[model samples]
Target: MSLPDLPTGWQVWNEEPDGRVILTFRPDVFTEDEYPAECLPTIYVTNGSRKRRPGAGQYQTEEWHVELFLEPEIEVLTETFDTRDAALEGAVDVAGRFADGDVDPRAHYQIPREDYFAALDRLTGDE
Candidate 1:
């Protein structure tokens, strides 16, 4: 129902009563005009228990999960937690990691945008 405490410069991007949340990092810097949609550092938390099949096995258990995306189709981190609070915490943790330069968005995919990478580095204080 409630969002988690995000890292510095991060804010809630989207949320739903059904327990779907999205947090975006440094919205002031990662503007739509300057950065592509894929370059956005986003953390997604979702709980879709009702969507799971009844006869599904243990692996299909409807538990909370936090996914960290450095870019579109590029999930750099995934963590599962037993409780929603834990999942939210995981999301915040990943956000901190991203700001700390522990995660690289461009490493996974061949992004030729030098300006984007440079802006990202500046945003994260790497430059």
Candidate 2:
């Protein structure tokens, strides 16, 4: 299936032949000098298992998953789907919600970065 149109500040970072897709948000602004690069928001669409085991998700599974991550270790949301297309659609929806300021990334952070959060609010029109 073709990739869907992404919301402002979001882009298709990568797509695998096996249907695993990675979408990134505002890579340009998430620099070391501005917002920490590690905090960049991302959406992963995959058909692999959600198990934490290292190789558990190496093989594709029956269910598709769309996961939103505020950081490498912080997951904001997860949605399951019956098909890859559905998962991609779900990812787009999640991206839209984030771009519209509907998803608050600040809540997931252990140490709040007030300056960064304020900048994000302006970027997402949440201010």
TM-score winner among the candidates? 2
> Candidate 2: which stretches are off by over 4 Å?
none
lDDT of 2 by residue, 38-89 (tens): 9888999999888998998877899999999988998989999999998998
Q: Please write out the lDDT profile of model 1 over residues 42-106, one tens digit for every residue.
A: 88887544234664322434688788876766787778888787888888888888887777766
On lDDT, the candidate that comes out on top is 2
| Number of clashing pairs per prediction, in order | 0, 0
Clashing pairs in 2: none
Error of 2 at 91 (Å): 0.6
lDDT of 1: 0.74
TM-score per prediction, in order, is: 0.76, 0.92
Worst lDDT window (10 residues) for model 1? 50-59
